[model samples]
Target: MKKVLATTMATLLFGLSFPVNTFALPDNDVSANSQVLEKVSLPNGGDSSQSEAGADNKAKEDTIAKKIEGKLEAKDITVWQNDTVNWKDGVKLKEDNAEFKNYLEEASVTDLDNRNTNNSNTDTNDDRAFKGKLKITFKDKSVIEIADQKLYVTSKMTNINNSKAPKNAVDVKLQLGEGVKDSNGTIGQKDNPVEYGSYRIKPGVNILNEEHPQIKNSLFNLVKLQVSDPEKYVDPQWSSGSANKKDFVVSKDNNIFTATASKLFTMTFKFVGYDRDSRKSIEFDKLPQAIKDKLPQEQKIKEGEAFEPNKFEDTIKENSGEIKYEWKFKDWNPTKSVSVSENKNFEGIWTRSKIEENPNPEVKPGPGKEEDKKERPEKENKPKDNSKAEDKKEIPEKENKPKDNSKAEDKKEKPQEENKPKDNSRVEDNKNNKKSNNTFPRIKSNENKSSSNKVYTRTSTKETKKESKTENLSKTPKYTLTINSGEYEVLINGQVIKRQMDVKPLIKNDRLMLPLRSLAEMIGAKVEWDPQTRTAIFTNKGLVAKIQIDGNEIVLSNGKVIKMDSKPLNINGRILLPISNVANVFGLTNGNTKDGIDQNIEWDGDNKTVEINLNK
Candidate 1:
C-alpha cells in the first residue's frame, strides 16, 4: 500500500530543539485515611483469593495513574472516582467506605506525581521530541521556516527470520513531507515544487517509497503501535529515545541545502558583398564546419540569450577565408576579432572586381620587325649607280615641283586665310609662328580701343615669357578625371561631379570634348562666359585660361597660347572645350598624347571612356 512517510525523519535530521519546563512540582499532600486500602479485603474466597484480588486491583490502578501522569503532576488538581464498590463486610465497609475512597484518590494523585518526577529524570538523560523550526534554503536566495515541527524516529523489522534483523537491516532516512512549506506554499508538490534535483532527503534514501525499510519502520511503529506497549515492543532501536538513536537528523552546524537553475541567449553572423548582394547568414548550428571546429564547444549560444562577446574570435578567423571567394570589401573586411554582441547580429561587407591583375599578357613584336625583314634585301641588292642617278634627278625635280606647287598652294591658302576676319587670322598666324618657334605668344591688349574696332598686337619678352611659362607649370594642380562618352557623368579623383550638364562628353577628331564650365569647376577652376565676346574664361589660383567661341587658340593668364585642332563649340548654350587641349594648356597631361600634349589620357574605344591622370 502507498503511504506518505511522516516527517519524523526530517525532525530528527533537523534536530528541532523545543523548550520544555524543567522546574519541579512541590510534593502532593498525604491524606489522613491512607491506611484504609491495607484494611480492605475481598468479599469472597479464602486468604489466597483476597491476596490475588488485591494484586490485580493494584496493577489496574497503577496503569491508570501512569496514563494521566503527564497531565496531572502539579499540586492543585482534584481527583474524583464514582463507581459501584464491591465489599465482603457490607456494614463495616459502608461505614469506612468514605475513608477508603478518599485514601484511594490521594494515593492515585501522589503516585502520578512520583511517576512524573521519575520520568522527567529519565527524559533528561534520554532523547525527547524535537520541537523547533525547520529551515529550507534555496539557491535562488529563498528561505523557508517551519515552526513547531516534529521529528519522529522509528525502525522496521526486515529479514523476518533473522534474529538481528531489527537492528542491522534497518534503513534510516529523513522526510520533510507536506509539513514543509515555504511562503509560496508546499515545496515538493505539483502546484509548488523545488527546482528539479534541488530537494534531497537525508541518508541518501528515496523517501517516496513506502516500503523503504526506514519509512516502513517509522510508519508502523509510530502509526501501528497505538494500543501496544511502546516502551518494550515498539521499534526501540530506531525510536527517538536518545540523541544517538536518531539517524536522519540534520547536523546542527550545517543545515542548509543547495541547487541550480538553467539560463540561455543568441548570436547571428551575416556576410554580404559590396553591392549588398551575395548575402549569406550563419547561426550557431548552421555555422560552417571549419568555423565550428575552431569555436569553443560552449560557444553555441541559445536563441534569444546572452553570451560572452569574445567567444566568436576563432570562428570568425576560420571563416574569414570563405568570405572572399574571389572578392573582398573595399571599405570593410572581416577579421578574427569581429564579435557579435549579445542578441545582436553582425554583418561583413565584401566586394568583387575591386582589384584585378592580368595573369598572362600577350607579348607583341617590337617596332618594325616585318618591315626590317622586307627592307633588308632591298638594301643589299639595289643598283648603286642607277639609284644614285635617280636620287639626283628626283631631288631637283621634287624641289622645283614643290616650289611651283607652293606658289599655287600659297595662293590657294590665301583665300582661306582671307576668308577669316583680318584681326583673327593675323593673330592666329602670329600664334602659329610662336608655336613653331617653341615660344608662347602674349597678346598686347589694346589700351585705346573701340568696341567695333578691336585691334590685337603680339608682344614677347625673354624674362617675362620665361616667368609666365614657369608660373603656368607651377600653379596648376594635379588630379584625375574619368569621363564616359554618351554618359553625362564625370569622376574626379574617384568622386563624381554632382552637377548635371545638357550635353555629355564625347570624342571628336580623336579629342575629348566635355562641358567647359563643369570640367573647369571640377578642377577647382572658375568659368565666366562673355556673350559679347563669345569667350569662356577659366581661372584658378591666379592662373587664367580663355577660349573664344569657335576659336582654336586658348589664352592663358601669362598670355601663353595653346592651339587646339578642334575649336570650342557652344552646344545647348554650354561651351564644350576640347579636353585634350585644356589638359595640355594646364600642363595636366602625363606626356603620352600624340600631338599637342602627352597621352596622359587612356581611351577605351570599346567603352568610349577617357581616363586622364594628371601629374603636375
Candidate 2:
C-alpha cells in the first residue's frame, strides 16, 4: 500500500482548497485560516452522449462528479490542514485504504500522529475550505474519533506471508457482530461515529494479528475481517451477542469467528474462502425450508436487508489446515484432520518436523474446530524418560556410597570444640562458594545520581526494610510510584522519562508491550483482557487513568485536569505523552517546540492557557 500522496499535496491542496473544485491553484493563491473556499462540484459523467442530450443538468452534474470521485476514490485525497469544508454529498471523495494503510504503518514507527493534522501550517495550498489534511484512513493504524470517541477499524489486503508489506500493523479486533468506528467517511447523519464498532472474521480468514498501530502490505483483502463503520458502524446483532433462533446458532468466541447453522449442519463463513465479501450471497440463501419457514418475520424473506436471499440452506466447506469441516443444512463433516503446518500455536506440527515458522503465520483460520483452540494451543504430551533417575539410583552415586566403615573414619577425623574458629572459616568458604555460584539474570542498574544527590529506588517492592537495605547503595532519596490515575507518559518526579500517548498495545523485543500492565501491577488493578477485542482493558478502584499512551489524552479517572503537550498522540501502540506536558481535554494531542508542552493547564484558565518551560 503506497502511502504517498501521489501528486504533490501542495498541488492537491491547491486543487482542493481553491474557489472552484475544477480550477488550478496558483502559488500566489496561498492563504491562511480565515479565507472561505467555495465548493463547486463537477458535472455528471453518466453516458457522456446521454448527458450531452441535456436529459437534465443535475443529472449531468452527478455523472461528471462521480467520474472525478471514482478517480479520487481509487487513491486517497489529502488536503491542507484545518481547512474545514462542509460538503453536502458528492463534493467529498475517498482516499484509497491501501495508501492510508502504508502511511499508518510508517507513521506508527515514525511517531506520527496520523491524527490532528489540523495543526499543520505548511501545506502551501491550505485554505479555509477543503482543510489541508490527509484523506481519512481506515481503522488499522488510524484511530478515527467520531464524536471524540476512540474507534478502531479492521482492514485487510493480500500477500502477507513472506511478503514485505508491514510489520507492526494495528489490528482492530472485533466481536462477532462489532463494526469499526471511523470518523472520516460519509456516514451522513453526524459529524462523527457514535459507537465504536468492530469486525468479525466470519468463517475463513487469517491475518497478521501481531501488533497494533500496524504495518501492512495491503488493507484490501486476503484473509481478514475488518469491523469498521467509517462512522464506527454497528450491526443489528452487535447489541445481541448471541441469538438462538431454533436451529440457527450464531456465536463468536476468542478471536476466531464461528457461525453454526443447525438444519444445514453448515456454517456460513466460507464467503471469504472463495473471497466473496458478503455472506448473504452464499450462507443466507442456503437456509432450509424448515429452517427458513420457521424464521421470524424479522428473520425471513426480507428486502433491503444486508443479508442476501438463499436458494436453500447454507453450505460451506472451511479448512482449518489440520482438519477440514464441511457443513450443509443438515450437519458438518470433517473432510480431513491433518496437522496444521505453521506455528504450533496455530497448528499441530509433528515434533520430528521442525515447525517451519511462517513469516506471515495465519492468525485467524476459518470456522469448524479452530474457534476454541486458537489462542490456547492444544498441548501434546511429550513422553518423559525416567532412565536417568533409575540409573542414578542403580549406581548408588557414581562415586560410590560410603559404607558404615567410613562413619567410624569420619568420627576419628572430626575436630574438637576448640577448633570452632576454624569451623567458621569453613562456613565463610561456603558463603564465598554460594556467592561465586550465584546464577541470576543480569539487570540494568538504575543508579545514576541526579543533582539532588538523593538516591531513588525505581522498583516498587523496596518499601520493606529488607528491600530498603538491599537498595540503599546510593544517596538519592527514595521516591514512590505516584502518578495520578490518568493517561500520562511514564515519568519520574518532575523529570520526563518516556513520553507516550496510547500505551494500550505495546511491545519490546517481542513481549507484551506493558505500561499499563506494569503500572497496574505497581498500583494494583484487577487486570482483565477481553479476548473478543484483544484489548487490555482493566479496572482499578485506586484510579488508573486510561491514558492514551500513543495519543495525548491522559484521562484522569477522577476527572482532574493536566496541561498537555498538544492534544494526545497514538504512536506505535504506546500512547505517547509529552513527558513534561499534561492533559485535560477530552481528546489526545502531540507537541512541537513552538507549541511547547503544557503542564497542569486549566482550560478555563483564561481560555486554555498553557504553562510551558521557556528555558528549554
Candidate 3:
C-alpha cells in the first residue's frame, strides 16, 4: 500500500509537469490533438509550416498525373496492284477475314498533344509541364499512344514507259502501298502511296485537261501511281519527279465506295402507293394482273441512265374494290437528278387522298320507286278511257245503248288489269267496278281474297327486310388490332389509333407486354382501374379479367384464376399486362388450318409485330 501511494504521487507530478497534450496518446486521438500540435517543432529541426508546403507540392503532382481520354474512328480500304483487275466489280470488305481486321488495329498514331488543362491546378508562379497523353483506341477497345512505332507496306509497279509517257490514262500501271501519317499527324501522303482499284477509262469519260473527269469527282482523283519496271521492285521516293508528283489529294483514311463508274448500272423509278394509316406501300408489282395488263406496257429502262415513272401516274384509279384508297403523288424518296454516273433509284411516293367507303355502288329501288310501279296500271287505264270516250263521240247513239255492251268491254279490261301482277292496290281501287261490288256474295268473296293478298305482300316485305339486315351484319368487316413492338402507336382496322400510349409495347420474360387500356379498347373491351387496390378490370362480351400490378395471376369473371407467364408491370403509372394472359381471358384461340380459318392472333417474330383479328 505504501509503495502504490508513492507511485501514484510520482505519476501525478509527471502529468502536472507536462501539459495534458504532452502525454503520448493512441493514433485514433491524433485529430483531437492536431490544433494544439500545429505549431509544434519536429525533432529533426523542421517546422510544421515547411511540412505543409511539401504536402501541397505532392498533391499538385498527383493532380497533374491524371489521364485524358481520346479516341479516333477510321475506315479500312484495300488497293489493287494488278492492271487487269476490274473496277466495275467493286471491292467489298470481307468482314470474316481475320487478317483484314488486324489492319484496323495497326493504324498509325502521330503528333501527340494534350489540350486539356482542367486536370492540373498549377499556380501562375509554378513552372511544371503537363504530361497528359493522347489515347487512340480501335474497334477492339485496344489503345495505343503516339510513340516512335512505325509499320511499313511495300508494292512494285509494272509496265513503266521507257520510251515515252502514255497519253492515255488506261495504259498506266499501278502499285499498292499503305496510307501514312506525316509528322504533323495529317494523313494522305502521296509518297509510297496506296493505289486505287484498276479501271479502263469509261467510253465517254474524259480524264485529260484541267477539268478532268477523275478530278471533277474527288473520289477517283486520289488514285496513286508509279512508273517502274514490269517485274522489278523500286524504292518509293517523295520528290517532285517521283510518285508524289500527282496533284490530287486523299482522305485521312480512304473510303472506297461500293460501285465505280467503269460498269453500267441499272436505274428504275417506281410509283408506289403509300398508306400512312396502315404504314403499307402498294408497289406496281403488287397490282392485279388484269389491271396491269390494261395499263400501258411498263416502259423498259435503259441501263446506265435514269428515267421517270410517269407512265403509271394517271393510269391507276382507286376503283379496284379491294381497298378504298384514292391515291395522289405526295413526294419522292431520292429526288430526280441529271447525273447518271452511278446507280440511282428514285421512288415516286403516292399517298391516300381520302378515306372513302364507296364512291359508286349499285343503286337499289327505294320507297318512291315502289309507288311508281303501283301507279303504272292507273296511268295505262287513263289512256284507255280517253280512247273509249272518243268511240262514244263517233257513235253518239250508242252512248244510250244497254249496259250489257259496256259490261262486255269492262270484262275485256279485267284480263289486261290482271296482267299487271305488281299493281294489286291500284286494281282494287278501279272506278268502273261498281257492278261487281253491288253483288253482295261476290263482293264479300272478292274482299276476303284482296285482304289475303295484302297480308301475303306485307309478310313477304317484312321477311325480305329482316334478311337484308342480317346480310348487312354479316358483311361488316372484322376488327384488326396491330401492335408493333417498341412502337408507341397502335393500328386498328388499318387505321391508326388516335390516342397515344405513354409507353411502347415491349417484351419481358419471352412474353409481350401491352398497355392495358389500348389492348382492351382495341378488342371492344372496357377497362376500369381500382387505384386503392392497384388493380385493372377489363370487361368485354360478358367476359371480365381482373389484373393486379406486379401479380402473376389473373382472375376472371367465371371464377377461374390463370397463371400468367409474367407479372403486370406498372411503368410510368400505366399498367402493362402480358398479351398471352389477356388473350386467354378474352377467349381468343388459333384457327384450324384444315378448316381454312384465319387465326385470331398472329405473332411475327421477325418484325416484332402482334396482330389480333377479332370477330364482331
Q: Report, for every candidate in turn, its global Cα lDDT versus the true structure.
A: 0.38, 0.29, 0.45
Clashes of each: 22, 115, 0
Q: Residue 338 error for model 1, in Å?
A: 51
lDDT by residue (tens digit), candidate 1, 1-616:
0011123322343555333222222235764234232332323533434565778787765553332322221111111112121211111112334544343333311121111111111111123432333332223323323344322222221222322221223232222221132223323332332432212123323233446553345432333212122221212121221243333333332222211111122344554433212223224354335433433222344322223333221212222432432343222111121122234443443333211133222223565545544453344344753464345445544677766656556544653675434433343343345334323322222211211121111112212434344334223322333454244333321223222344677667867787765566435566676656878788776888888866699888896888897877666545677776776666555333234443445455555455443322
Please give the ranking of all candidate structures by TM-score, highest first, separated by commas.
3, 1, 2
- Per-residue lDDT value at 599 in model 3: 60
Q: Model 1: residues >4 Å from true position, as ranges?
A: 1-485, 488-500, 590-600, 614-616
Query: Each candidate: RMSD to true structure?
Result: 34.1, 39.7, 27.0
Mind sharing the TM-score for model 3? 0.26
Who wins the lDDT comparison? Answer: 3
Order candidates by lDDT, high to low. 3, 1, 2
Candidates 2 and 3, the one with greater lDDT:
3
Model 1 / residue 260 / CA error / Å: 93
Q: Write the per-residue lDDT of candidate 3 for residues 121-240, one digit (tens) a residue.
A: 121213243333334444444444533221111112112231111123233322333232222333332344444333322222222222543334432333332323312222222221
What TM-score do all the candidates reach, one by one? Answer: 0.21, 0.16, 0.26
Task: Say which prediction, candidate 1 or candidate 3, comes out ahead on lDDT.
Answer: 3
Residues 86-122 of candidate 2 have per-residue lDDT tens digits of: 2111122355556533443332111122443344322
